[model samples]
Target: MVEPNFSSGRAAERPDAAVGSAPLAEPAAGAAIDPSKEPEGRKETKHLSRSRLIWRRYWRSAGGKIGLVGLAVILLLALIGPSLALWDYWVVDDNAFLSMPSGDHWFGTNQGGFDVFAMTVEGLRKSLVIGFAVAAIVEILAALIGASAAYFGKKVGMVLQWITDLLLVVPSFLIIAIISQHTAGSKSSTWLLIILLAAFSWMISARVIRAMTLSLVNLDYVTAAKFMSVPSLVVIVKHVIPNVASYLIIDFTLGVVGAIMSETTLSFFGFGVQKPETSLGTLLGDGMASATTSPWIFLFPAGVLVVLLLCVNFVGDALRDAIDPSSKSGGAA
Candidate 1:
């Protein structure tokens, strides 16, 4: 203090006294820094799984949001509408025959005096069940057959391809009609119909999946798995299937619509879900006879079917867009 430590002060004041250590200059007042604009080395990294990313993109789209809401409403109605109905679907009320929409009969009455509302709800439930069952079965078959053929790529592949080609060439509608007719009166006709629809429906999806799998089989991860001696089935299930899951999801959704349409067409022609077990097809078939005289009968079921298919197709389209990186509708991550 006596000498004011002039040497030390001078040393501290020297510009390069600390060598590489330099004081960081404070940013100018009110000058905010954007973290997102930081250099690559300083930028924060975010990791999202494939499914989460798909969902994020899907929900961000207007069509996806609308379709999801519509589908949910339809499902909710199918599940709970029956419980809220005033009359039983099977219990005939002769007094209410050919009734118009009233507080008691929300959707009016059929010629048989059954509650149209109750029947519609029941039919919706059955149709949804059949559609989902068929779609799930078809997707499973497509994935298994496609992945196996692509992964094996030899006699096994050829045999599977041959089967797929043969099935594709066969008149699926005729075969399904014939088989369903025989099983229509059986107790498990619904299950039988699901199986029949699934069997014929998978060929196209299988071919598409096969083509995708072929490309994936030569990828680095697949090659690594092969080098590791991982089982073929394991690789197909764990690695191959996941890579092409977006396509499978879209196909499954479309499959549900196709199955429902097929079932409806079969029922309309008297080859599908027979009496005692109602379906949308059965409802539509019965309604078609006196559609002009009793418009409600035809209009309600037909309207529901149209809406259901539209919702499903919309959802499928949105999912496709969301999953495809090249789609403009997918927007940002």
Candidate 2:
């Protein structure tokens, strides 16, 4: 079994150090003694009490509170808004669409006569689903690529890294557009779009992770694990990932938020989700056309989209900060 490498203050004393003519002798049981075992005579420090540490650390900063509140609001909206979206996303109902904001219609209506609020809620669901799927795929792909490169460095790793670098220079939108157009808008196209985006996006993350893994691989603890004959995969999974998980989580959130926004932008520009099937992007696009005459169409959908994106970014930042040792200040009392 692996043991923690954390240093304890205590250390064994050396016999060579003598005081005056008499040598130091071991103390009797229950007598006062030095905390450290080493000749340095350092005392061992006690771990902080959990409750005391928690109390000491509670008031970190104002930003954390704001982040928490924003996260909660987004979560509540995600859950409640979708649950209350009863009507068909595409269905045109006069009362539902183009109606002014009131108790009956919280977000007012759209040109197609569909409830803007319901459609927005439904759109959020779709956006979130796509975002999560894209992020997960990207993170997994990146982690694997990074691990492969770092663990087995050679021509293969160099070539792969080079390819990733090359891809990074290209405009992502153009490539995705070309691919989407070639597929002819089938159901497969959407999934393919997601996969392609994720594949391309993973390169940067993989490179970052590779750098981190490379540094960690040389550490004594990691070398010891290797010496212990642990399987490479297990070691990577258990030791490597846990150490870098904070970066991965933050990277994933950033990727997902970007993917969702990119999807929305593409759809808005008519290179994305086709007519009839609506996403937040589609709603925003339609809203823009008649926006001058009926600003509600644009305002409601765009507002929600902005809020959703901002919320995601905020939460992502919070998590990153919370996990980062530098940002964390107080220990829990």
Candidate 3:
């Protein structure tokens, strides 16, 4: 330093020696930076699960909302209409036979003097019960058979496929009619009808489920689960079915309609829900005979039936569109 070292002089004269830290350019005037804000492209949003997303899309659709409302009204009627009736469904007023809609009998009386309003509500409840029962049983059977066949493949798959094919070709209506005719008056008739409907209904759905399961079976996650020593049943229950749940749900909805129609047809033909135990079908059958004479008998129940089916179809369509990402009809608003 005393000798005026050149390196020290150079360092002292350097710009870096004059400043304690590197300088950064100041932002332009009025261009403030906020740490709380993120770039639009990098902004994060909350994630929703598949079911919640589907539900959101479904409720947003006009048809879905209408359908849901209609169904709720129908269900409310089915549940409470009987209790509100002035007379019980079984109560017959000989003087009120075929009476027109009056304050005493809101929906009038049938030929047998049974309260049409009460009977109609009872029939709706029974029909709904049968439809739900058949649909649930069919779906369970289809899921089990279809998933098992796809997962096992080989001989097991072939046998199941053959059975399914055979059943598909069989005349389900005729077979059901015949079986139901024989079991008509039995104590277990309702259960028998449910089983028969489920038995025939499952074959078609099983085939569809099998195809879907086959596609899922070879997926990486499924394969990984298998490799990790997970049980086949567990993998199928946990992975396979969940992946195909959308299809199952739609199928179940349609199945309910189908089952209800089937029961109605059979009952109309005297092969289901035998006498004394009325269903919508039985009411319909009775109404047809005197339709022209007493239009109320046919009009009210038929109206309810039409409404039920329409609502169900609407709901099913909405569900299909909502659950399927490829669908454009029920896109989020």
Candidate 4:
């Protein structure tokens, strides 16, 4: 205590020492942050909109990539395939009856001398059209009926629910089969078939939509819209349906597959898609008789149908996983 501390005194007197000992100044309000020094999980981030986020997750999925590519290729084939064929689907090649695949007649000719390639392309196009049409109708009907039922509960809800329940228990396939058979000869039979398929297919989906709407109708935004004197239809369409759009999208994908299968079944049994207009099912039915004698007829159309259905299933699975935050199959967002 009696002796002076030279080092301590020097340290106190030294400007460099004082500088070293002083606390660091705070960063300016608008200074650029050094990314390297940022703490984990505190780095600057960009926000993603719901659509973008869903697309990001879906694109990251292996199934989604495969499905999308496969679908695109199939669509391309459907659009331009007929032009590539040597003969029209219904045109008979008198000389090349029941022939195997060749340079002139790719995919061979059936018993009727019709080009297999051309028939397959036509069938694919028709099936796709019907599938998309039916799916659209089903989604629209389900959304409107289900959302309306949930929003206007009590008498209207009960009636809608009753209708849904009735449809659920009814033999839809039998009803559709009977109706399609009766209308098979009409000029608008194809459209009629699509409508029939859509009518029966939406019941289960409507129930699901109703359940979703019940949860959504009381949300703050929905309530606000209602209080603002917005029309009921406008509120349901703008607010309620959008909230359930993910499910609707997934349902639409699956619905396409189902509609195609249904149409195929009906056509195979001669109840749907009458002659002069062919479908995959009709081709399969015609080919079944010659399967053993000529496998090409059965194989080509069968292959296309399998591929289309598989792609649809993959897309549906990917969509479901992408939409569900709890699902891990879509990988990290």
* RMSD (Cα, Å) of model 3: 8.1
How does each model score on lDDT? 0.89, 0.73, 0.89, 0.92
- What TM-score would every model get versus the actual structure? 0.86, 0.74, 0.86, 0.89
User: Candidate 1 or 2, higher lDDT?
Assistant: 1
Clashing pairs in 3: none
- Tens digit per residue, CA lDDT, model 1, 1-333: 465545555446676666456554657999999888788998766899988999998888887788889999999999889788888789998798899889988889999999988999899998999999999999999999999999987899999999999998889888878888777667999998888888889999999999889988899999999999999889999999998888999998999899999989888888889888899999999999889998899889899999999899989999999899999898888
Candidate RMSDs in Å, in order, are 7.2, 11.9, 8.1, 4.1
Q: Per-residue lDDT for 1-333 in model 2, tens only?
A: 998644421222444655344545668989875545556546455687644443334335354456557757766776788567655566677655467776766677776677778877777766776788899998888877787677666786798798889988989888887777777447676677677678668888999999888877777887899899999888778777777787898898798788898889877887666555567887888888878887877888888778777767766765565565466543322
Stretches of candidate 3 off by over 4 Å are 1-43
Summarize candidate 4's per-residue lDDT along 80-153 as a digit string, tens digits: 99888889998999999999999988899998899999999999999999999999999999999999999997
Going through the candidates in the order shown, the clash numbers are 0, 17, 0, 0
lDDT by residue for model 3 (1-333), tens = 377656655445665654454444557899977746758877667799877898998988898999989999999998888878899998999899999999999999999999999998998998999999999999989998999999987899999999999998999889888888887677888998999889899998898999888988999999999999999989989999988888999999999999999999989888889877888999999999999999999888888888999998899999999988889998863
Worst lDDT window (10 residues) for model 3? Answer: 17-26
Per-residue error (Å), model 1, residue 70: 0.8
